[model samples]
Target: MMSDVLKNCHHRWKTLNQRWSLQTRLLYINMLLVGLMALGISVAYYTLTRYDKKQQSRERLNIAFKIMQDDFQERL
Candidate 1:
C-alpha cells in the first residue's frame, strides 16, 4: 500500500516536472514554504493573544474581589 502511494507520488512529480519549467517549480516550492510559515506564525500569535487576555481577565477579577473585601470591612 505504501509503495503504491509512493509510486503515485513519483508519477505525479514526474508529470509536473515535465510540464513545468525548473524556475516555475522553484517558485511554487518557495510559495508553499512561505505560506506554511505564515500560517504557523499566525497560529502562534493567536494562541499568545488568547493567553494574555485570560491573564488580564484573571487579574481584573482579583482586583475587583479585593475592592469588595475592603469595602465590606469599612462598612463593618
Candidate 2:
C-alpha cells in the first residue's frame, strides 16, 4: 500500500511539473508578443515624426523661395 501511494505521489508531481512548464512557456510567448507590439508602435511613431518634420521643412523652403523672388523683383 505504501509503495502504491508513493507511486501515485510521484505521478502527481510529474503532472504538476508539466503543467507549470507549460504555463511558463505561455507566459514567455505573451511577453514576446507585447515586446513586438511596443517595437512596432515605436517605429510607427518615429516614422510619423520624421514625415512631419520633412513636411515642415518643405513649407519653410517654399516661403523662403517666395521671399527671395519678391526681393529680386523689387531690385529689378
Candidate 3:
C-alpha cells in the first residue's frame, strides 16, 4: 500500500518536472531552500529566547528566596 502511494507520488513529480520550465523549477527549488533556512533560524531564535527567559525567571526566584531567608535569619 505504501509502495503504491510512493509510486504515484513519483509519477506525479516526474509529470510536473516535465511540464515546468528549467528556470521555473530552479526558482521553486531555491525558494524552498530559503524558506527552510528562514524557518530553522526562526525556530532556533525562539528556543534560545525561551531558554533565556526561563533562566532569568529561575534566577529571580532564587534571589527572592535568599532575601526571605536573610530576613528570617536576622529576626532569629
lDDT of every model, 2 decimals? 0.98, 0.96, 0.99
Shift of residue 75 alpha carbon in model 2, Å: 1.3
Candidate 1, 1-76: lDDT as tens digits: 9999999999999997899998998999999999999999999999999999999999999999999999999999
List the candidates ranked by lDDT, beginning with the highest: 3, 1, 2
lDDT of 2: 0.96
After superposition, the stretches of candidate 2 with alpha carbons farther than 4 Å from their true spots are: 1-20
As a whole number from 0 to 100, the lDDT of residue 1 in candidate 1 is: 100
The estimated TM-scores of all candidates read 0.80, 0.69, 0.80
- lDDT by residue for model 3 (1-76), tens: 9999999999999999899999998999999999999999999999999999999999999999999999999999
Could you tell me which 10 consecutive residues in candidate 1 have the lowest summed lDDT?
A: 16-25
User: In model 2, which range of ten residues has the least summed lDDT?
Assistant: 16-25
